[model samples]
Each structure stands twice: as C-alpha cells, then as structure tokens.
Target: MNNKKPALRIGIIGGGISGVALALGLCRHSHLQVQLFESAPAFGEVGAGVSFGPNAVCAIAGLGLGETYLHVADRTPEPWEDVWFEWRRGSDASYLGATITPGVGQSSVHRADFLDALAAQLPEGITQFGKRATQVDQQSDELKVLFDDGTEYPCDLLIGADGIKSALRNHVLEGQGLAPQAPRFSGTCAYRGMVDSLHLREAFRVHGIDEHLVDVPQMYLGLDGHILTFPVRNGRIINVVAFISDRSQPEPTWPADAPWVREVSQREMLDAFAGWGDAARAVLECIPTPTIWALHDLVELPGYVHGRVVLIGDAAHAMLPHQGAGAGQGLEDAYFLARLLGDTRTDAGNLAELLEAYDNLRRPRACRVQRTSLETGELYELRDPIVGANEQLLGEVLATRFDWLWNHDLDADLTEARARLGWEPRSRGALRQG
Candidate 1:
C-alpha cells in the first residue's frame, strides 16, 4: 500500500497579472501543485501602461521580484523628472492647484514588461497557454474544471482570476438565486496609446512649456472628463489616456465575444480633447491612432468565496482606473490569499473557513476602492454631485485623496486578518511593505 500523501492541487483560470502573481507566490512553497491557464495563445500583449503606487511596488518587491522590477520599471526619480499633477479648469486650461512628489517608487511599467517579469519568475511548465476555461463544478471530493478543448482538470481548490468577463465567475454565481451579472459601462470611454516623447517634446517646446517638464505626468481637468498622461518605457514613450463621459456606449453591457479595444482615428481623438488645454491637445496630437477602451465595472458581489473556489482581481471586483489602483488591489489579493493558502497547517478541514476569512477580509477593502474610484472620476471631471462646480473643494479632494491608497501597509493588514481567524503562526511568506 502506497501511503504517500498527494500534494494540494490548485487550478487557476486566466493568466493575467493577478493569476500570474498567485502562481508565482504558490510556487514559492513546493507543497502546492499550481497550474495557470490563459485564453490567449501566449502572454505579453496587455496593450497599455500600468501605474503602481508605492504600496503596490512594495508588494511586488516582497514577492522577490523587486530587483527585476527595478530593472524593467520606470523609476525615473523627481527633481530630474519629478511627477507634477496639475488640476486645471477644463473650460479654459487654468491651473487650479498642483501637487509635486518625487517619482522614486511609484513605478509606471509597460504592461508587457511587467507581465514578462511575472511570467519569468514562475517555474518551467507551470503556466499552460491557450486553455480557455469553459466550466467549473465542485464535486463531493474535488472540483472539476472543463476547457474548450474538451479537457478536464480536477483539483483540490480553484481560483478564478480570469478577469472581468470570467467564465468561472459565472460558475460560482450559478444557482445562488442570483442571475449571473455582466459588466456595465461606466458611461465613459477612453482613447489611449503610446506616443513618442519626441513628438510631445516638440509640441511642448514650441508652446514654451519647459522641455524638462515633458517627462513629468500631467492631468487636464474638464467638464465631462479628464486627460492623464505619463511617461513609460524609460521615457522612450509617453502613455496618453483621454477619457470622456459623453461618448455614448448605448449598449453599456460589455459584449462577450467582441473585442474591448478598437482603433479610433486621430480626428476622433482630436475632437474628443478639443476643448481642453494646449497641453492636453498636444498630447492628443501625438497619438496617430488611438485604441478606444470602454471602462466597465461591476455593481458588487455579496462575497468573494463560493465553496472551495475563490474569485480574485477583476473577476471579483472590477473598478474604474481613476485611482490607478485596480491592478494594485488585484496584486494585493494575490499576495494576501497566497499567504493564507501557503500555510502548511491549513488543511481541507479548515479550507472553507480560511476561504471565508479571505472573503471577510478582502471584500470590504476591494469594494471600497471600487466606490472610491467612481467618486474620484466625478471629482476629476468637476461634475461631483457634492462638489457641484466648487473648484476650491476640488483641489482639496485631489490633493490628499490618494494617501490611503498609496501608503497602505500589507504586512499589518495580514496580521489583523490572521487575528480575525484566531490563528497566528510564525510568519512564513509574509513580508512587510517597505
């Protein structure tokens, strides 16, 4: 009789940032057999620049990717290339108030580079590409996962990090007296792309804006929406994102089979930011072809755990990008959950309780960020129901609203969560956010 125990099997759907992060974290502890599936044929086509606050940078660093992240990230510090965020009255391009901060650790990275960094950290043969998940069902002893290729994987636990339109999300919500929900557009769409810094330099230089200032981040506030621009790829290119609330996506629901990204002409982009400042217009001029992204967010999920399956990242709580913390929140989820699951003492008997603990701790925080992101967008557009065109309060709102999001301490949060579960073992994989 062979009595060797089988390893705990973990099946993760979707290979976006969050899924990849979780796979990397679980791989740190050899007891877990981790497998990640992606719908795409391969990784590294995320199609945009991602900004991570100091808090998220610390999370990435704690995951043992700090040095690699520093190599691939845009860490151009301030005083040389200081970050300046100016809130100008959108109607005429007048400065409201400005906040200056050193760009030391708030790393903005190319999505491909970031994904590549994460994918590289995983052990060989762990991530399987082109596996689109079709169905997930919990059986008496294990969970069964089906793919489009007519293959099935039965595992001890399942995680649906599949992203906004997750098929696994649909599975978890099935038969809960809740009709599966689809993502709804936030009444806004954005034209985003990478613009060569040379084009922006020429545009700003001709306008008498300092050439040095071209590398810094900028925000152009307006009536219906705003323009946010920042440098990425080591200042080789600038990422430009211009958002507008007027663009009517009448069918606000995200189409399942349709591409969320489509090409938009320069004329459409120019017309979208036409009424904004010279700086905003200049940034728009640099984008020859822009990819329009319709922002969609979920209303809310009552919880994040269903049986042994848990939802993370966009699958659980998708939000607006106004805070630039959506990905950060997802990374936080990966790290926090990984710590709980990595504990050797955690067994099948307590797996349900531990997952419920994850839901109890993570859901409120992620959902709060979702609500905060919505409010932040309204404030940026000067259309806040509470502010109501009050420019003075708008400045106040922009100045310190992000302190909580940027300076979060993950180690402390996990400690509190551990106490809530009434189990405190010596720290294994947890690290304080430095």
Candidate 2:
C-alpha cells in the first residue's frame, strides 16, 4: 500500500456554504486534517432565495447530497421559463421576446436549506462557530490564523472562503505590497422579498394582473431599472427583486442583516415602479415588506492563490448576480480545490504547481462569467432595440459559452495531474467521494 503521511494540515476561514462544501469534498481523504472557523453563533447558513443550475446541481450531486437536498428543499421541474423584457420606442411600449429555453436546468431553493445539506455532509467535530478569524499570518513553514477572541491556530495551508469582505485576502495582498478594496455600491439598490404563491395569486386577481404572472420568472425592464420575480420552495413562494438606479443623493448605510429589514414601504415601491407594467405592480404589491440590498461587486484578483493561502468564492472573485452563479461558482471552487489537494503528486514541493493549475483552470472561465453577468445586468436595464438584439444573441449563444463549465469533471483533472507527474492511480474513486 502506498502509505505516506498526509500532505498537509488545512485551515478554512469562514463557515459559509463554500467552506462547508469544501470540507465535505475533502472528507474521504484521511491524509489531511481540516478545521473550519465561523463567526456565526451556530453551524448553519442564513439567507433567502437562491437558484441552483445543473452545473451547480452536478457539483452538489457529486458530493452525495442530492437526495438530502431534495428532501429538505423543493425540486421544481421547470425553474426558468423566460427572461422577459419591455422595450419602449420613445415612450411607446412593446413586449420584447422572452428567452424561454435556458442553457442549464435550474431549481430554486431557500438558501438556508441548501447550506444545511452541505453542513450535514461535513465530518463531525471539525467546525468551530462564533470564532471569527480576524487575522492571518504567513510563516516560513505554515500559516497562522488569529481569531477575534485572541485564540490562534496554525496549518500548512489556509483557504479564505471568508466572503467578499475577507480578511485573509487583505493579509495576503498586503503581504505582497498590494492593497485590496472592499466592494462599493453599484448605483443600484434591490428590493427583495418572498411571499406565498397563494397570496400572490389573490393579490394579482384583485389588482388585475396577467393570468400567466405566476407561471415562471418574469423580468420587467425600463430605463435604467428592472424588476425580476421567480417561484421557489416547490412553487409555494414567489421571490421578487426590484433593481433601481436612482439619480438622487445616495441612501444612508445600514448594518448587514436580512435584505428585508431596510425596505422602502409598499407606497415607496409604487412610486419607484409607477410606470412599470400592471403585472409587476401587482407582484410588488403582494410583497409583504421588501428588504433592500445595495448591489456591490469586486474586481478580479490578479492572483487567486499565493504561497500557503488561497482565496475562493466571493473572496476571490465577487461578481454581480445577473447570472445567479455567485454561489454556484463558489461550490465549483471548492470541488476544484478538492481535485488539486487530493492529487497523487500533491506534495509540499509541488503545492505551488497545484495552486497554479487551479488558478489557470478557473480564473479565465470565471472572469468570463463575471463580465457576461455584468453585461446581463446592463441588458436587464434596457429600453432600447440594442438590448432586444442582445437578448436574442444571449439565448442563442448561452449554451456554447457554458459547455465547458457544465461539462467539467474534477476527477478528470485529478487523473490528468497524476498522469503528468508519472504517478499511477491507486483507486479510481479514491480522490472523490460522491
């Protein structure tokens, strides 16, 4: 038997889905000792609605959590029906085409349930909650992490799954004489909320909305603003998000809490969306109270990995939610890292090589998605002919763009890496668990 001491001790900062999912990916490996640190009070995730496309579903299913995910969440057959649009010819309205066919199969879920499934798959006694990682120190041999409560831990590798506002990102860049910037407002504020489908239907009935309003996701576009709505939780609830680019003075800042705590009342919503279609008006009216999230995005890092520390998810490349792949890409990062670390040739001397391979495999693809998502955001705000043309092209070209992403198999990469290093495969399925 090829018995060798486990390659390295791994430490993960931040206990979000990315961290926990990475833990599950690394579970079958007895070669590495892993620790996950979180700032939250408990070992779970908190959030509202999110989408999981087939690419994301493939990653999760590969982790052996598909059945568990379905048990705790809704599994809709057709989650994405259309990308609706409204075009105005000098104030005259027209219904632009709704791109019904999508590149990937998708399902919506309450974000909390998705995280719970991943957390359940994690090995026991490995997660440390309420222990906020305030700092990371890169030593000559290992990386040292310091918590807010003055406790310290060390490991051979450090993974910053902390989030967009990652402390490790700053530490690594500053260590290399580069300063990282936090995400800033994108001049758009989103009003997000979820309501029961029955309530939505009743409200629409009294207000005279389109009969097909509840069928699929609907996007109402205007000049510099847009409204998006979709069904979730087995179609039990409808989630709505209204994005507006206001010209007035910027709004006041608020603490990071549920998106609903800072809502501009129903009256305010009506004022903002007064000129929108009646269907959107009814959907907005049905929302109990909408929480507002100021949209923000981060510029791509020049390097995603450095020395013993590497960044993943929002920490490495935070993008706008136009494609709804922020969380999915994070899951991809976790799975990709599992492939790298579990490789037969993954030794201390070649750790840098593994990191480079990971960056090379992911950065270009992710950056393309990031740029396309931004373009989609601009497309969503269209009230012009150009946007209509772009929408048609988007529907036609989406599949081509996502082919490599959706078809990627980390096991293949791991196998390739081992072959490149002249190592024989010990077991076909040893590198991956699910």
Candidate 3:
C-alpha cells in the first residue's frame, strides 16, 4: 500500500488581482495546496478603472470566476470608437484622423470590484493578511518567509506574485549582488478621475458619446495629450484618464505618500486644454478631482525565476497602460505559472529551467506590448504632424490586428504547459472548470 501526500504545498506572496487569480487557479488542482500572503490590511486593488479585453475576460472565464465578474462589473461588448484628435492649444478645434479599433472585444470595470471578484473565489482561510514579507531566505529544505512580526513560515516554493514594487524581488535580486534598477519616467503623466454621465451630458453637446458610446470605448487625441473615457458599474459611472507629457525626472513608484502635492485646480486643467475641443474641455471641467500619476516603466529582467522562487505579474514585467494589456499580461502570467507549479514532479533543480521557459514564452509578448505602449503614448500626446500620421497609420495598420489580441484561449495554453513541462495529465473524461 502506497500512502503518500496527494498535493504539493505552495506559498504565494501578494494578494492583488494577480495573486488572487493565481491562487484560484491553483485551487482547481486538487493535488496542490496554496497559501497567499498579503501586506495590506485587506484585499483590494488600487486603481480607479481597468479594461478587460477578450483575452483577459477569457482568462477569468477559464478560472470559473467570469460569472462573478459579470455580476459585479459593467459588461459592455462594444469597444471605444476610433481615437479622435484635435489641437488643444490652437484657436480652432480641428479634426485629426481617428483610429477605428485596436483589436478584440473589450469592457471596462471598477478596479476594486475586479479584485474583489478574484479574491472571493478563494476558499476560506487560504489568505493571511497584514503579513508583510520582510525577508525571504531558504531554511533547510524549504523556503522560509520572515514577516514583519518576527515570525516565519516555510514552504516548498515561494511565488513572488507581489506587484511591481515587490519586496521579495528586492531580497532575491539584491541578495544575488545585483542592484535592482529603478523605474524610469516615460516623459509623461496622467490625471485620472471619474464623473457621472449625467454631469457630462449637461456640460457639452456630446456628438459621438451616446447610449452606444456608453458601451463603446473612446480615446481623443490632442497636442501632447490624450483622454480616454469608458463605462463602469453597468454604465452608471464614466471613468476618464488624461495623459500628458512630463519631462521631469521620474518620480517614485505609485502608492507612495507625498504629502506636499496640491489638488489639481479647474484653472490648471483648463490651461492644459487651452485650445482643445469643447468636448474634451467639457469632460475635463466635469472632473471633481484628479489624481496625478507620473508614468513610469521598468527595464525587462533577464529571468523571471531563480532557484525555487518564481516571479509573476507586474513583479516580472511592468508596462504602460496604452496597450490596455498591463493587467491582462499579469493575469496571463498568474494562470501560466499556476499550471506550471501544479505538476507533482517539479523540483528545485529543474525549476530554473522551467522558469526560463516561462520567460521565453512571455518576455517577447510582454516586451512587444511595453514598447508598443510607449509608442502609443507618444502618438496620442502629439501636437503636430505626428498626430495626423499616427492616426492614419493606426486606421490603416493597427486596429485590424485587435481580433488576435481579444480571442486568446488560456485553457489551451495550460494544456500545452502540462505537456511541455511534463505536468500530471488529467483523465480524458474528467474536466475541471477554473
């Protein structure tokens, strides 16, 4: 009689969307035991808005959490109409060419609601909050995680699903005698806020924004800036993001406390849009208060995992939101790595090789989006000929390839991972959802 344990115990750091999504995926494998650690006091995400294209929605659907997402989120099938452009500083608001579509089906949702849906799917007692990881080191045969309270927990593998500002990443990379590179400012900043659709309707003669535009996504281009607006919470709230150029030195990473910053005045915002269209200026006026973000991007790391520790989501790759795949790519990493770790045969020695393969598969796709996102930002912030050229090129070249982005099958990717990495095979008749 062989009486061995059925599941492999794993420790996951970070409890954001990426971490929670990965935990839910691992839970689907009855042979895997997972524990998640979060630094924050509670489970929630920190952004105002998020866009889930077909690719991301498909990933969530595969996790069996799509119904929850649909219940809590505003599900809109239409994408924003072609991005329009006008010179904000000019006397006349001239029409710059518009971009039709980017690729696939897309929808917008409140960031917190999306995170909550992912966290809700986890079984009770699986997540431990208020446990900030202070240090990561190997203790005997297991990976030891030391928290701020002077306590430690040991596990077979430590998954640093922690976000872009990851403490575990610092411990691992710095411990390897490599100084972690800081995120550089991309010469841009963003002012984000949300307003009621009623206020916007009362403010301007909204031409393109109607009932259809509520579900449809829209980006308006200007000289050295662009504004994107979309619906959330069943089209009850409209989320707006204003992007502009910032030539100053890159600021600190987000979620930082800077007490000296003043509120963005209506006057300052109006000055920024001195010559923009009535529509663009009208939307800016409707904003109550805007949170400014000095846009930043990090250089790609050579590897995602070393030893028994692997990186996922923003911890591995952080990109601009121009492509709208920042969260989607992170979700992809979570689903991909969860499947890799579900294999019973995975061990420390071959773990490096497996991680390298994960990087090989993910890096190019991520890097491409990173670069494309930067270019897209540049195109939207243009105030001259670049804006016209970009719009023309986007209509002629870019929007057609969106179908490929929205319709990816993440489950099939997992199936391939099982075969490629020698993971345990499921019985043909027994299919598991999520």
Candidate 4:
C-alpha cells in the first residue's frame, strides 16, 4: 500500500531573477512540485549591470546562488574593496564623500550574465517559456492561471514574480475588491550604456581626469541629475547610468501605453550632461550609443497576500534604483518565501497561514526599502531641501544611509517568520544557510 501525501503544485509567474531564484529554492525539496512560467521564449534579463550591497549578497548566498553569483559578480580590487562609491561634484569633480561598505563593495554583474548563470542551475522540465500569464482564477482549493495563449494552468498556490506590469497582481488586488494600481513614473529617466574600462581609463587620462575613478565605482552628483559608473564582467567593462529628472510637476506621470525603454542618440545623452566636468564627460563620451529608460515604481500595496495568491519582487514593491537595492529586496523576498513554504511543518492545510506569515515578515521591510529608494534618488540629485547640496551634510548622510538596508539579518527574520506561523524556531544550521 502506497500512502504518500500529494505533492503541492506551485506555479510561479515570470522568469526574472526573483522568480527563478524562488523556483530554485523550492526545488530543493522533494515534495514541492515547482513550475515556472515565463513570458519570454527563454530565460533572460534586460539591463546592463546590476549591483548588490552586502544585504543583497547575503540574500543571494542564502538562496544557494552564492557560488554562481560570485563567479560572475565583479567586486572592487584590494584597498578599495569596501568602497561602495566615491561621490563627486558633476560640474568640477570635487570630492564630496565616499560610502564604504565592508566586505561587499559595489559588487555588480551584467544582467544577462547573472541571469544565465541562475538559469543554468534550474532542474530540467521546470520552466515553460512563451507562457505569458494574463489572469488567475482562484477556486476553493486551487488556482487556475490563464495565459495569453488561451491556455490555463491549475496549481495549489500561485506566486507572482512578474515585473512591474503584473497580471497576478491585478488578481490579488481585484480579489480584495480593490482596483489594480499602475506603476507611477518617478519623473526620472536613466541613460544607460557600457564602456570599455581600458578605453575609459585612456579617456580619463587624456582629459586630465583621475584614472582611479575607473578602478572603482564613482557617482557624480548634479543639481537635477547624477551619473554613476561601476565595473562589470570582472572589470573588463564599466557600466554607466546617467539619470536626468524633471521635477516641475507636482505629481509624477507617464503615459499608460508608452514604452518604458527606448534607444536614443548619443547626441541627446551628451546634451543632457553638456556642461558636466571632465570625468563625467569622459565617461559619457565613451558610449557612442546609449538607451534611455523611464524609471517607474509601484505605490505601496495594502498587502502582498490574498488567500493562496502572493506577489513578490517588482510585482509587490518596485522602486527607484538609486540605492541599488531593488533586486536585492527581490532576492530577499525569494529567500523568505522559499524558506517559509519549504518548511517541513508547512502543508496544504497551513499554507495560507504560512503565506500570511511571509507577507507579515516581508511586506513592511520591502515597502520601507521602496520608499527609501525614492528618497535616496532625491538625495542623489540634490533635491533634498535640508541637505541642499551641502557637501558636509551629504558626506555624513552618505556614510550611514545604507547601514540599515545592508546590515539586515535574514536569519533572524526567518526565525520571526517561523514564530508567526506558530512553528518552533529551527537552528541556523538546520535550515539551508546558502
């Protein structure tokens, strides 16, 4: 007589970093049947370079992707391994301050490369591509995920790891009789491109700018704009994102049907930073082709959980990129959710409560990060009324601004989450410590 408990059918929407990471974490358990549906035909990530602070690094490690991440992630060389970014005035290159984050400073990876590394680790027959989810139908015991192709998938639990424009988010909001919220444009557009590190070094030297800027990450701040550069691909390339903001409007806005990313000419990028200092101009000149990205973030949701459906990553709390914590928060989301769902005590009868515990533990922290990210962008662009470009005050704020975000203890949070679920705390060694 074979009397085994039925496996839980877990469906994950979207195949971005958080989705795949969560899938990987859940797959570690033999009883959880995980299936990942991606809108794209294959696993991929868009964007040039993504940096992770110490907090993100720990989350990545906690998710069992530490080796893969470290394999491709670029870190500052010795003597500057702790420097997050050196801040300078965009007009004159005068040093403002430097943010030193010990152990993991400006660690970054090309988006595509990191995603590829993560995708390689997935178990076979786990992911389906070209499957764009349109809506989710919640039944009494199971949820039906409808795709754009007129097909549907029935699962025990559904998780939305989709990007800013999420279909399952609509289901979650509508389930509670609330209207879905659209992503709000932050009135900031980033001009992004990559430059050859060696060539950029030569350009810096030719323009009589410090070559040291190329060796480590640097942020040049202006009145209404800021330019940041960090090494990627093992320092072979320098990724640059130059941001220009329009703050005239009292409230931020973006056309509903407008595209978020588009290609723009080098001339347009140059004109935006026309009067910047030699170092800033040198970095900009290296990129003959640049693409502009309209930055948008989601307003805080009332909750991330509604019955068996949950939202993670950008679907829950998309934010500005100023603090470089967006992806990290997503990874943290994956870590907590994966740990909670994979707990031995978690089962079909208690899944909803476990999810609530996950939301209770994660929602507040992620929303705080989201809010702080916007404020950080304002601080970066010198829009803060109090700081107002005061170099001394800016320096002091920069030194400790990321302390809370970076110094977070994920294990403790996991313990608290277990407590919320009325489960006894497990030792750190007993759980997968990444």
Model 2, 25-92: lDDT tens per residue? 77577767888888888766545877765677766766656676667554334444323222221122
What are the per-residue Cα lDDT tens digits for candidate 1 across 1-434? Answer: 98645678899988888889888888887667889888899886566888887777777776666787788888544554444365666655566766544454336889888888888878888988889988887877768899999888888899999888888777677735566878877878889989888988998888776564466666778888888877888888888888888535545555677667799899988887776667678778888888998888987887777788899999999999998888888898888878877877666767887887788777887888899998888888876889867888887777777877777777776786676566876365654232
The parts of candidate 4 lying over 4 Å away from their true place are 1-3, 425-434
RMSD in angstroms, all models?
3.6, 5.3, 5.4, 2.9
lDDT of model number 3:
0.68
Instruction: Report the number of the highest-TM-score candidate.
Output: 4
Best by lDDT: 4
Work out the TM-score per prediction.
0.91, 0.84, 0.83, 0.96
State each model's CA lDDT, in order. 0.79, 0.69, 0.68, 0.89
Instruction: Give one digit per residue, the lDDT tens place, for model 4 in 227-270.
Output: 99999998899999999999999797888778899899999999
Task: Output the lDDT of residue 200, model 3.
Answer: 73
Per-residue CA lDDT of model 3 for 1-434, tens digit only, reads: 97655566778999988889889888777767789999889997777888876677767766667777778766445333333211222222343333343443345678898887778778999999999988888745668889998888787778888877777776656645777755655666677888787777766545543443334555776667778777777777788888777534444344345422245866776777677776677778888677777677767776666566777778777788876878888888876776676665665555665676576676666666677677767655653344454556544444444445555566665664455566646446543221
lDDT assessment of candidate 4: 0.89
lDDT for position 66 in model 2: 67
TM-score, cand. 1? 0.91
| Model 2 misplaced regions, further than 4 Å | 1-3, 44-46, 73-95, 100-104, 247-261, 383-434
Misplaced by over 4 Å in model 3 are 77-104, 175-177, 206-215, 248-263, 343-353, 383-390, 401-416, 423-434
